[model samples]
Target: MRRLLPVAFIVFGVISGVQCGFGLNVTVSSFTKSITSSIGNGINLVVKANASIKIAADDDNSGTIRALIAVSNNVTTPLNRLLGSILAAATAENVNSDELFVNIFSLVAETRPALDAASNAASDLQKTTKEYLYQTLSGNLTELSTILTNLTDGLDYLHLQVYQAANEEYPVTSKNITIFINSTVIADITMPLEAIQNYLTHVASVITVIASERTQVIKYLTQMNETISNGLRNIQNSASGFNRTVIDAYHRIMAQQVNTFKNINQTYAAIVSRASSYNGGDISNLTMFLSDLVAANASFLQFVSLSTNYTMEQINPVLQDRIAAATKTLTRVARFIANQSAINISQHANQCAQRFMQKLQQNPVVITRLSRCIQQDSNALQPTVTFVQYQMDLVRSAASSIANQMSKVCQRNTGACARAYFAALPDHSQVIQNKISVIAGVVSNDEHVVTGRIINCLYGTGADIIENALLMTKKFNRCMLVGP
Candidate 1:
């Protein structure tokens, strides 16, 4: 049961990442396992990332309103947590994917005890986990950094090799391999980074809240030279494992993405090998071209070279771009979840705090005793005060991180969306350009041979050939202006 959740989570994450492919390749479904991993991983990330959103059930739900209004209602009784209402609203509303994230957050809130086992476990390790995660997430992910670097290097090497081979194999270099290839892979990675960043920001906020609560409890007890009440400690202790579970969820999701990256790395290596080593080992898409090249047919090398160029320069970039775009959408949806979560938790916490304050107000004797203890042992109280201050600082830091990350996501996603196209222009656009250029050259070269004075004596057959070439050029020119 423990492992099953992570597997499911990875499936969601990978599936979300994979859908951002260029639509031209009908063969993209070949990566069928990716969908499984995407959903499996992403589900956990969404749940863990969604913790704060469900701080309390929305009272607007009839079930919850009825529950709250009941005289015998107890803390143990389940509240609506807005799960059904949020989902129904999501479906009926014209909101984008962002609202879907809020629905997930609401559901997580509804299932708090189930989702926040880390907190319920009452382990101090949750704090440790939060510290480490904050450090790791705030910095670079080494594996991802390495993968992107290698991908860039591999693409560069491919470009160098392609340039050297372009003249000999195809007798012309038409496409700008560097501009189209390298640029798009960057887009592929951008969306995942954005998505993960959103999840992590909320995660940091949850931890800060946990830490702050514990510190407040400690401060309250230190004034009396005593420990906090069992009830108070238990409330704080319930949060001990929450941050760790959130971190674990992120890792589970990212692990699947790392696998996806590895697959792309392998594909990149295989394609580059075709140029770098110039071997005919097992290029899946170019069986016919490989066969022709192996048979020592130089003329077929043009077809082989063009096929390789099409695969490398056009298709792969679009595939990566699509994945990136899909991830961006997934991450953008995370915002609504975070916003709803913040509202619920703040309101719920305030109510709980007010109840605590009213109970203390009714206990003048206990308040007087606590005040005397603090006045008599001001020095003894200094340490707890400092700790509370430190925790408040952590909350501030986390809030800052959330703001910064959200700002960056907005800037990058909005900018990328503004320039959106489902497929790369250079994918088939360059092909159109190449075909037109080839036809124009052919027509220009054969102008004298076809439409010269000799064509008038030859029953105008050469003239007809020239006219057809002009028509073909016009059609191809139109194609170049738009796309294939």
Candidate 2:
């Protein structure tokens, strides 16, 4: 407390102003009053400086005590704000992560229904193709049987003509005539059979080849679709659980930080309160305490600034990028699956029908007369079975091309999709490592700033101010500092 100044000023001024005598008589009352006022002014200035330090040790009306009274404030705002900001940032980040997970999960769910539909379409296409094979062969067989009768009648007439013409030239033998007639009938009858065989061969070629290819494609599709759907579903479940754990940890980290700030503030405030009551009417300790308080405020501000930098520059930006990448990659994978599931081989059915119809229209083997076929056996009316073999080859080649092409495309697309999905899931390790490096640096820098700069500044400022009151003259001290 600064009680020494006013009393010393009044006593010294009166003692110096009165003439030295056996009987005490005070002569310069005005001079004593002027000296006391002058002394008071100087001490008042020092007291005010002490008061500003936030810890006032003395209680008095004069200069030093007044300064002591003013030092009684506390450190508060910056600490609270620093902790609050951290909690807010953590809360926001947690919410965003949760939202991203939900979106990806929903997209994965959408693919299953589409996959089932695609499988159904494959089954329909197979049925239609099988029915076409059955109907075409059954109707064409009767037409071939009628052609056989027409050929037989023509052969008999030819034999009769030959016999009639030869009667005038030579003796006709019944056995030679019978042999010739039988041979002609056999030739005529076998022609239509060859045509029927050609038709059956081509029909059989389409049925066997096309059916086998279709079965393989559909089986591959079903397996691929099921694998993707199940894998995504598993990933979605696991990722969501992990995210919840991270979010909860983040919340706890933020809460602990806030509590740590509160504890620090309370400790310092209590210490400063104790510091103010220590020395007898001396404000130097209080002044020093106030300096440290101001410095602590600076330290807290630095901590908040650095912590914020860590989040904004390192943690938050990385989190946002991860969220976007996760969302984008997951959505892309889901879309591929859904689109594949919706892939209808039904669309290609029309193309197959159109090609089959056009081939029948242009076909000399199926729609034309037996005369249209080039004969392999000259003596017989039977057309070469070679046309039937070629037509069978053509139908087989066309169906195989379409089925194989579809299967190849589906395999290529789904294989790529599977690779990409796996790539995205395993990507988190690298991203997390990057974020850890950034946050680690920020934490180190913030700790240094808070513990080193602000704390050191406060201690250094107050440590050098010991006996600062003695720097003034005796008269100055009488006004500024109270004597023990």
Candidate 3:
């Protein structure tokens, strides 16, 4: 029992030591946990307060400390809000500078309204004072002269300033606040006082001059109105008479000329249709046949000789008369042609063909009658040779003149007038050749007229036509001489 008691004591002592050590450890751990919790709570409270304040500090030490504390405590929202507010304040400062400029301009403009009103009041006062002085003084010459001189000087100075302001270069300086304020003070107070003193001394004279000028202006305006009214009435009557004369003359002369041209155009068109058909047969073949006929027969020679004389004597005269009539007809015809429906060759082929045929038929009858008359005069043809020679010479001369005129009108180049003239030349030569052919056939008993008379006429006419056509072509070269 004694030995067990000793062993139990030793075990109790060891157990006590272990229990004491565990208690000490528990006490230390509890103390540490309590201190850590208190420190963490203090840190959280400091972070929360700092976050609510949104502190902004300029120095690096304070800013860095605040940023570090904020990051460590996870207070980012407060730091960001503090940064945004600081930026907003900076932006506002910049905006205020801009607003200052606009405010300054508005204040300056507002000053002008009051200044203008005061100026107007001052002017009225000067006028009223002058009237009173004039009434009181009546005719004080010396006083009036002095006052007038002063008033004139003041007005001249003001007028000079106004003129300078108007003509000065851009970016006006006098209109600015500092300059305007200074100028207005000088003009209104300093200079005007001197003018006022002068005005007080010689008010009557100034008032009289002003009243006299005002009367003159009124009289001048009245005279001007009367003169203008009288002049306008005279102009109205003259214009009415002139208009009537012009209208009547245009209707009577120019309109009649136009109508006549229209008729001549219709006739020319008929002639062209007739001529087209006449020449429809193979001209080359006919020319060859006539050449053969002239070479084969002596009777044909006699006939050609007789026909030549007759053509010169009788046929040419009749033809000339007919040409003279036709010329007049052609003038009207050309005018009518100008007014006719514009030719659209593609769409109205039938109408064009009909018109062409009708024109051709009308002139052939005249040609045929004249031809027959010449044929009948074979025996009497010799006596009329001189007249025929004279007629041929005249035709040649007329053709030359026509060619020159056409050249002048047509331009030498590729103008429409030049084209028309050239195109017509060949056709005209053909007609002349045909006439000579008829004469030759009648006189020479040749079936074909190409041998003598027709060939001669063709050679003569063709040469003239070519010369004229070339001359007319030169006119087109001078077309550029005409100015816009």
- The residue-level lDDT of candidate 1 at 264 comes to 31
Model 2 per-residue lDDT at 428: 31
Error of 1 at 263 (Å): 99
Tell me the whole-model lDDT of each prediction, alpha carbons only.
Answer: 0.30, 0.32, 0.32
lDDT, candidate 1, at 415: 42
Model 3: residues with Cα > 4 Å off, grouped in runs = 1-141, 144-217, 240-244, 276-484
* Model 1, span 356-460: residue lDDT tens: 323322332121222221123223223422443343334223323322343444444224421231122223233333432342233233322322222232223
| TM-score versus the correct structure, for each prediction | 0.19, 0.23, 0.18
Q: lDDT tens string, model 3, 24-51?
A: 1111112222222212222222233333
lDDT of 2: 0.32
Residue-by-residue lDDT tens digits, candidate 2, 1-484: 3221221211112224422111112222232233222222222222222223332223111122232222111001111122122222212321333343234234323423322332232233333233453344333333433443453354345334433534435543443433333444434433433443343344334333333333333443344345435543543443344334333433443443344334434533533465433223233433443344344434534544455344234422333343334334333332332222222234433333233223222222111111111111111111112222333234234323322343345444235532342233223323322332333344445433433332343233222221221121222223223321
Which residue pairs clash in candidate 2? 1-281, 1-282, 4-482, 5-478, 43-479, 43-480, 53-290, 54-71, 55-71
Instruction: Give the Å error, residue 222, model 2.
Output: 2.7
Q: How well does model 3 score by local distance difference test?
A: 0.32
